[model samples]
Target: METTRRAGAEIALTEMPDDGARGDVDAATQIAAYRIVQEALSNAVRHAPRAPITVSVIADAADVTIRVRNAQATAVAGVPGGHGLRGMTERAHLLGGSLEAGADPDGGWTVTARLPRHPAPEASEGTL
Candidate 1:
């Protein structure tokens, strides 16, 4: 969130750990979540710099859910096309998780990823 702010974006962030257990998530799971957020933030800054962004991350016993939403762009920056979404989807699936990205009804974009707290052996072994 701080990184996005430094990039000149106003973000509203919400982070919560279920049962008040902040350390419930494994290192690998944590890393995947971070990367998803990182890419989402970067995309928001690039595609909609002046739009308000809201990020929510909720971690529970079974999984971590991350949602990054950016309002409609206030200015036309440039064309948008990239492999960021693909990479994010692959990372989540590799961790026995899932990701969804698309335009919101309000003319914005949203990226949501849910990664298991404990991935299967094979899934975790795969390169992200």
Candidate 2:
């Protein structure tokens, strides 16, 4: 969680170049991404409290990849699960994206979301 916030703060401080870019995301989407990370971190802290959590965000010419991974179920008992995971999934879908949540091969939980750069056009020019 701390790592995630630090990363977001760092990115927020960095400035972008002046070169023309068509796929520049608005503040809303950026906020959404940040929120998603926050939610993921919170979940990890609550569910797998003692586990180490890693949140990564990578933006390239094509798309952005957000990943959150934490150590598997701890020895402790009584960890209820449902709402938070479902909410995260829905949020990703609302943005025309997808979310994946499952156990990692190396014994951990990994949640990843990929939001494409180009979404479907809302309407055609002459359709109306």
Local distance difference test values of all predictions, in order: 0.89, 0.61
| Model 2 Cα lDDT, one tens digit per residue, 1-128 | 45745544211222233224535754434555666777777776666666777767766554556888877656346866658778777666666767898887877887887654443443111111
Per-model TM against the reference: 0.92, 0.68
**Model 1: runs farther than 4 Å from truth?**
74-77
Candidate 2 TM-score, C-alpha based: 0.68
Q: How well is each residue in 17-116 modelled by candidate 1, as lDDT tens digits?
A: 5867778777778889999999999888888878999999988878899999999876455656799999999999999899999998878999999999
Cα RMSD (angstroms) for every candidate in the order listed: 1.5, 6.7
Task: State the local distance difference test value for candidate 1.
Answer: 0.89
Off by over 4 Å in 2: 1-23, 73-75, 118-128
Model 1 scores a TM of: 0.92
